[model samples]
Target: MRTATPPPPPAALTVPEVMTALRLSRSKVYDLLRTNQLKSFTAGCARRIPTEALRQYIDNQMGEAA
Candidate 1:
């Protein structure tokens, strides 16, 4: 018998990753950040979005659609 390995912890996403996940352009992603629709923070000079924040943004969009 063998023990199963635990999954790695979720990490913050970069701007490009967020853009790819949302299927939006670079400008649009920055726009969302600028408008406070998506929440993010800067680590030094790099911008990073928390996984929870991304999920929350998606949930908000679905709620608005419904």
Candidate 2:
């Protein structure tokens, strides 16, 4: 029997990934970061968004809609 492959570890998302995920423009994603609506960190010159932060943002939006 073949063993199943383990899933890859979660990784921080780049700005482009966030844009694709949210279907928002690059400026909009940066706007969210600027306004503190989304949390992120910079490593050197690269900005990355944690998966949990994105999830929380989504949850907050859902809550607001209800």
Candidate 3:
């Protein structure tokens, strides 16, 4: 019998994932979240950042930068 390998996770990322995606520091991520620059929300009263939103945020930021 052959073993089946698990597939990779989707783009639903957490706070740390957002930070890595944005290549930003932890404090900067927090600041962005505070300033409403990055899209996120509190799940079960805990803060969570979605990967797609972070990607969109990055694209917008790059657009602004350009």
Identify the runs in model 2 with alpha carbons over 4 angstroms from their true place.
none
Residue-pair clashes, model 1: 0
Compared with the true structure, what per-residue lDDT tens digits does model 2 show for residues 1-66? 999999875678999999999999999999999999999999999999998999999999999999
lDDT of candidates 1 onward, in order: 0.95, 0.96, 0.80
Name the candidate that leads on TM-score: 2
Q: Residue 19 error for model 2, in Å? A: 0.3
TM of each candidate vs. truth: 0.87, 0.89, 0.71
Q: Pull out the clashing pairs in model 1.
A: none
TM-score of 3: 0.71
Model 1 global lDDT (CA atoms, 0 to 1) = 0.95
Ranking by lDDT: 2, 1, 3
Model 2 TM-score relative to the real fold: 0.89
Tens digits of per-residue lDDT for model 1 on 1-66?
999999875678999999999999999999999999999999999999999899999999999999
lDDT of candidate 3 over 1-66, digit per residue (tens): 999999876546677877776688989989998998887878787778767677788799799999
RMSD of 3: 2.8
Model 2: clashing residue pairs?
Answer: none
